[model samples]
Target: MRILHTADWHIGRRLHGFDLTKEQNHAFEQIEQIALDEHVDGIIMAGDLYDRSMPSEAAVAQLNQMLQQLNLVDKVPLYAISGNHDSAIRLSTGTPWFKSTQFYMYTRLEQAFKPVELPDTQLFLLPYFEPFAAQQYFNDDSLQHLEQAIVPIVAKMKTLFDPNKKHLLVAHFFVAGSATTDSETQLKVGGLAAVPAGLLKDFDYVALGHLHGKNALHAKNARYSGSPLKFSLSETKQEKGVFIVDTEPFKITFKPLTPLKNVQQLTEYFETLEDKDFYKDLQLDNYFGITLKDRKPIPNVMARLREIYPNIIALNRADGYETNVEGSGESGKQIRQKDPIELLSDFYKQVAKDDLSPQQIKWAQEALKIAAKRESK
Candidate 1:
């Protein structure tokens, strides 16, 4: 049987205040096409369906539409679980109806032991669980860390896990030796954060998530599908896609998807950045993190760059060119070059990565005036 493994959808996620709804929709379209083209028997989504615990109405609509198209219209079986980013209570709202439609969502710790039996494999669903919660659920006071908490759980699953059939563990957790990106949320605390690779070495296939990089961990047959689209500049170099696995001999291959817009970083001097030929063949419309090596601050540098790179996400100084808060080339100087209003505006544009609204500008001006009056006294 052929199955598709995907995770960290992060639907409705945004980048530096830029709405990513359209890009996410475009990625989902590719996923649907891939599923149809591959003719997979089942799909496994490990976790982090949404970017946050509380998603917007539009985000809800987006997920609902995809579910209808996949599980209902296409009639493909899907096994999903909630990550730390998801609100288990919210995602489990329509559990009964979803199960009938071949969309099995496991969000609670109690549902971890249940297996979604496919024709050739038993897919075990293990959602993200807190150490404290697992300690209470199993009534085992010895559960001090994530691995410690999960050790007994997997031991129990081993009793139910059919050795004769192919076994797949669908879980959201950090495994040892996995590379992480800035976009991923930190779910573990203290020393017991990462689960040992040996813990899941026995499974035929382990589809994991929470780490937003594929091939991130060192294990027997485990893979992280990663986020479909780049969520941070750090992940710009990652090749985001889904994994297709065939059960009999246990084979896995990646199928790439082109995102609607790319996340990238550009490092160059102001003069080089201004030359149109510098990025002639490059796609100029992508979201960018820009760094300038110029030693002195350029007047209206951000404004000038925005005229060309409209989707710029950050304006930063390159190594050895860091400036003081007042935009001075040297440090330890009084921040008096620019007034409070100009400084605030510059800060807003750099951090927000977008132009401030009229209301924001007004607030800044009034607040600066109050500061100026206080200074006069």
Candidate 2:
């Protein structure tokens, strides 16, 4: 059976507070197009179908629309599991109905492990689970580690799994070989946090998720399809794609997907406002995170950049001597002559939003004063 392996859709996810619904929709369209073009028998989404456990109504609508399009327009079966970001119950709401449509979703560990038999292969779906959840599923208090908890589950699954047939396993977990970035949230860590790759050796091919970077993990028969979009500036250089797995002979190929908006980080040193062309050189069509090195504070720098690059997401000024102070042997330290509390109040006034509550402002002021005193010592 030919299958497309993709994961970490993160539908309804926002980047730098900017909504990514449009980008997500565009991506799903590409996925459907790929399915049609490839004539794949099935599409397997490893996990993280939504950005949050309690997804927004708009998120739900978008996901439903995409699922319907994939099923109705493409006429392909989609097997999916809930990741750490999803609420198991929410994703599994229409399990019975979805199964009829050949769009299977597994949310709970108890509901997982059972092989969903297709015409060409038997797929073992393992949804995202915490240690506590695994413990509850097995009804065993002795299950202390995630590896240990999964051992019994896999052992039980192996009995049901027909070794004679082509078997595929879908899972969402943090394996050792995968890479992680600041943008991706880490799973809960405890004694029951990890499940080793060795446990899945019985399966023909294992499609994994949880890490965002493509080619982050290495296994002879296992791989991560990676996220469809770049989630962070650190991932700007990554080639985002999905994996195409052929189960009959057991071969895997990567199919690249286009990203709606590229993310780029730029650093520049500025001595005067005339360095405007430096900002213009960057691709404004993509989101830009910029760091400016200036000897002194430039008035309305962000406003000026906004004129050329409207999609600038973040800005930081390097505080080194060259940027903040020119030709000064001693580090320029502006002495605060005002009362500590008043100085803190002014600092809060500069950074706090207009909608900040009075209590919040008061607390911030006090916290800043305490912090400053600690630093002085």
Candidate 3:
């Protein structure tokens, strides 16, 4: 059986306060195309179907439409679960109706342990679990870690799973081998996070989620499909893709899912802009994120860069420019020509057209001094 493994759709997710509905819709189009081209038997969405537990109305409409397009329009069986960002009850609603459409939504662990059986394999769907929830489900208080929580769940599943049939496990959790980027929101508190790969050794193939980068984890049979769209500037250089698992003999392959647009972050020194050849080579129309490094401020850097790169998202200085010096030591280092707090106070004063009071000025100076001390230490 040919199955497409994809996760972390994060529908309704935004980038720098800009809505990503269009990008997400385009991704769905690619997913549909893949289903048709590969003749996939099933599409497994590991988790994090939406960006938040309480998604916007537009997000809900888009999600409903996407599901309809995939399950009804294309007739591909889809199985999905809720992640830390999803409201389990909300995603699990209309469960009975969805089954008729060949879409399985697993949100609660206590529902049932029946495996979704295909001609070639049996899938064991384990949604994102909390420690308390797992403990309650199994009535086992000893389930302290996430890896330990899976022991009972998997043991229960073993009763229903046929040893002769190829076993597939779908989950949403931080696994040991996975590498998380700065953009991924932390899900667990303390060191009680992450399930070990050894916990899933019994399954023939494991499809994972939660991590936003493709190849976040490394296991013989486990993998993360990653987010469909780049959600953060930190992910500007990541290559996103989906996983394809061939279960007749049990093999997995990753297929690249193309995005509508590319995200790039380029840094350039403004002092070197005298060379037209350097600026000519930069094609900024493609969602450019440029950083200008200059000792002297250019009057209209935004306007100037826009002439070449129209879609500039942000512009910032990379130089060691200090705006405040709270708690700075009286070291013999080059004294700042301008008081850092005074600069900040001046900036706010200009914006508000009001001068800082004596108390405010003193507070700012103290804050800057504290910052300086921390830096020196």
lDDT tens digits, residues 176-234, model 3? Answer: 76776676544434233778798788888889888888867788888888888887777
What TM-score number comes out for model 2? 0.82
Query: 1 or 3: which has the higher TM-score?
Result: 1
- lDDT tens readout by residue for model 1, 1-377: 88899999988788989999989988888988898999998788888899889999999999889888899999988999998888988888888788887899999887888888776788889998888888888898889988799898788788888867888899998887786555543433422388888888778999998877785765659988888888888788899899998878778989998988899999999899889899787788999899998876576889999888889998898865445643434344444666666666766776566777899889878887898899999
For model 3, what is the alpha-carbon lDDT of residue 32? 82
Q: TM-score of each candidate?
A: 0.86, 0.82, 0.81
Best by TM-score: 1
lDDT scores of the candidates, listed in order: 0.84, 0.78, 0.79
lDDT of 3 at 362: 88
Number of clashing pairs, model 3? 11
Scored against the true structure, residue 2 in model 3 reaches a CA lDDT of 91
Count residue pairs with overlapping backbones in model 1. Answer: 0
